[model samples]
Target: MTQAPGGGTAGRWAKRDASVVWHGFTQMSSYLDDAPVVVERAEGHELIDVDGNRYLDAISSLWVNTVGHRVPELDEALRRQLDLVAHSTMLGNTNRVVVEFAEALASVVPVDRPHVLFASDGAAAVEQALRIAFQLWANRGVEGRTSYLAFGGAYHGDTVGALSVGAGGFGTEVFDPLRFPVLRAPGFDDPSCLDVAAAMVAEHAHELAAVVVEPLVQGAAGMQMAGPEGFCELAEVCRRHEVLLICDEVATGFGRTGTLFASEQCGLRPDLLCLGKGITGGYLPLSAAVAAGHVFDAFLGPDPSPRTLHHGHSYGGNALAAAVALRHLQLLEERRVLANVGVRSAQLARLLSAGVAPLPGVGDIRVKGLMVGIDLDPPGPAMRWGRRVCAAAVRRGVLLRPLGDVVVLMPPLTVTAGEIERIVAVLGQAIAEVTAS
Candidate 1:
């Protein structure tokens, strides 16, 4: 075990971390016993621990870092904005960077007259969209349309409103009492999925506020993918039923799925789009809930009447975050990130299907642009092959975090072909080592 450079011991950080921080989704009882690695610094595609070991960041720091870590442009953008303003409430007033970000986003997103409502992170974006959906209905004289429709195996987020629609996951067990009722349809790719969704809309159209989905790929749900065929079909269903379609593109946005936005691939425009993660290239925490003109129009009324969407975070449109996001968008356009994602996505799919998927214990391999998922059959003991693979990959100097039983990889969009090859090579070796042992 590597120790910290400070005097007392190498694992001091772990002990200190364990003593104070209660990590999310972690079993803290055995935290220090296993000696957690404390990250000291990061560079492009690499993270260095306190012990001075370097590891390739195969998961892009939980699928956020697109332009890569410590980029000069993003750092400078943040610094420049910080020199002016850092945080502000997104009520009554707006900042210049925030306005620029909204304009840049509107130019790329599919909706005409797209208006952005800022938030701080992915889950917050989900919450904002949910509230907007319900508020739109209420403002339109449809006071009964408060229930939402979500797919089984969907994972929108962890917040109360987000969790309400996130079915087929154990995460909501503790919060079930507090969560609102949300109708669940059969997940995409199920034999009767579309039929099930149609039936739900038919049965609940009068009461449906919205249908939220992780468009194209359901990231937290084992990276389960549904092609554009069903997505376009679902869009039509939502339109016909007058149910607002909310595309949770927090994971698939910013060219992660070979397109600037996954909704574009389906030839469908969502009523509300939730974007985060790579929006600021992982430089700062930022998210946006974009709505069409019709949706936005629903909230326009006299000031004292209070028909507005009643939600705003303290740091909703932080100027630094907005500036960073603007710079990141510029970088994406300048580099033609979608083109790179397309090329690398195809190469990764071919390489993994031909090489890694055939290995022992490897059951299935799925790829979408820069995002990839490796499902291990039977999952074996430890019960979560994906989590084990992540730990194993770390030992082999590759940083990865898996979703349930899926050993997933979502590297930065800026990664080179050579880096892609090395990432896959190390991932394959890690899979073999973990499965073999």
Candidate 2:
């Protein structure tokens, strides 16, 4: 065991972390005992802990990482930006890099004349989209368009507005008092969720400002997915009703779903889109709320008047973030990442079907591009199979995380065939060990 600075054994780092830093969605009293990985640094697709242990980051660092960590091109992009500037207010003024990046993004996002409002994270992006949808109706003098329609099993973000639209799981029930109500539709797990949502939209179009959905995959909802055709039908309903459609692609965007945006696969051109997670290749805090030309035009009357949105974030369009984001976009094309996602997604599905599906402890498997969830079956309502299975995988040098009983696998886009095999082998071993014991 290595000796760390403050304590004797480096494992004390978790204890030190528990004493100070409060982690989200973690029980602080059991933080140190839970044996959280004290990550010192990362290389390629592996995270190196303080004790010099390297674990394959099978979850893509909670699905934020896209290409890989410590990427040379991204590092160079950040360094080049640092030579000029770091951050400036995007409030009344704009930065050069912001314009350049936004132009690149606008050219690609699946929206008519997309205009981006940058934010620091996904929650803010979703919140911005919600606010824009609400204000669009108010600005256009449309009455009774105050409520929103969001599907069940949808997890947008943690902010109040985002939570209001979200289906509310993952220990978020305590904050229900703060979450405003929205028209609820069936979750993606339901075969006819999209059709049901469309019906609800048509029935409640009078009071609906927008219908918010997570296009192909409801990521936080245990990677639940629906067919692309359902999304197309729901979008058509939103179009016919003249209710703005908002796609919260904070998890499914930036090639996570076999395309630049999941909306592209679903043939959707939403009025507003929320983007995050992989925007800067997991390098920085960057997200955006994209508005179509029509929605953008709604707020175009009188600059210093009620039409103008009275909201701004201090570090909305930080130059460093924009610089890295621009490079990331270019690299996505240059490296042919999306094509690789297709090939690997097929491989992943095949491998899971052959190796993991028939196990006595396995229940179900879902895959959409590189995003995956393997549900575990425990006899007699056993608890924490997910947590134990993930911990066993970590001990075997592959990092995995779970949502309830669904173990997620989200490797970086650049992951190789051998790495995928290694991940699958380790997960199978982990599951075997846990179920046997």
Candidate 3:
């Protein structure tokens, strides 16, 4: 292949990026020095960069591509929809695809009676959920029930309201001044943690609007795995306190936790469920805040009043996204993706525990479905170990993104058994190399 203008393959693209594009969550000034990989195209499980390096895409391209890259069904669905309509305001007008998608979602979304309210992404969905829950309380003329309870290591999203309920102990220190105070309990997975959570909710129930949580697992918080016991206890406490229970299943949804939804594993249903990320098979940005029928009733009022839900995005229910999402669901059902996740997840857990757990400096390897977090011990050496190990794995072909010493694996659900073994083997080698060095 002929190289671009400046020098290497990505020279032209790099120059263009340097002059115009400002990437998110990155320091652009030093970006040119490192020169980010320019992906040319993606096959099923691999990404081909401008330099022709093939990466396994083990992180699922930031944990969104649940199935795989260049999925023909999803791509064709988007293309078909694009040929018809690409953009339209979803404020008053509705799309046939969006309506159908909502119908499909309502059938299996865990909530007893679901009414879908679309949004652009996970954070927006979560914000809408929190707003709806609070608004429902307000509409009922409930006095002082306004606060939200959350777990200590919870990470919902980056938006203002999401930042509010998200615990401040993490890297959110800069946003502390801007965040609203939220009641937090111990990490939900800890033993006897339910009692602590219940006590906190009971104390604040009179002033609590909702208790929002990432059901069974908290993703961004180092891919931490919390079992259903804590979630069930929290749900029971919320039920007793009359506080709304909002479950953020953006990461754990769509069979990531070996179930259709993590709530199913725990047998607990929340008043509101926020979903996104893998909702559209990672093809498009689509999210929804699903509320029960009673919660929806709060928004229905006789007059133009505060009971109505005033929050909605212009791309709230895009026809193309919905079509793609609906197709993604059909693909899931047609392929039995949930059962695949369960099988693959068990295989991965066993491989990690048997092959990688004995490595030096390795603390714990927690696996829930495809979401695996291998936590390393100590901050100094282990942090460097994680970075080096991930870099080595990248060299070996798998793309693993580590979170401050925790190497997380969130591969596509369609990954084959051979790919699973390779992934585990590469990770094992990476761990051994890092620790030995």
Q: Which of the numbered candidates is closest to the native, going by highest TM-score? A: 2
Cα lDDT tens digits, model 1, 82-101, are 88988776799988889998
In terms of TM-score, how similar is model 2 to the real structure? 0.97
Clashing pairs in 3: none
Over the stretch 1-437, how does candidate 3's per-residue lDDT look in tens digits? Answer: 21222347766678788889997666688766544556789999988777676788999988888889888988999999999887688787888888889999999988978999999889999999999988888899987888898887788888999888887544568988998888888764476666687889988899999988887777877877776766677788889989899989998899888887898988778899999999998888999999988899888886678888889998898888999999999999898998899899889988889988887878888888889999877446425666667777876778887877889999999888889999999998888877776
Ranking by lDDT: 2, 3, 1
Instruction: Give the per-residue lDDT digits (tens) of candidate 2, residues 78-137.
Output: 999999899988988888999999999999999999999999999999999999999999
Quick one: best lDDT, which candidate?
2
- Clashing pairs in model 1, backbone N/Cα/C closer than 3 A: 3-10, 4-10
Candidate 2 Cα errors over 4 Å, as ranges: 1-9
**Greater-lDDT candidate between 1 and 3:** 3
In lDDT terms, how accurate is model 3? 0.84
In angstroms, how far off is 351's CA in candidate 2? 0.9
lDDT of 1: 0.83
Off by over 4 Å in 3: 1-19, 29-35, 378-383
TM-score of candidate 3 versus the correct structure, residues matched by position: 0.94
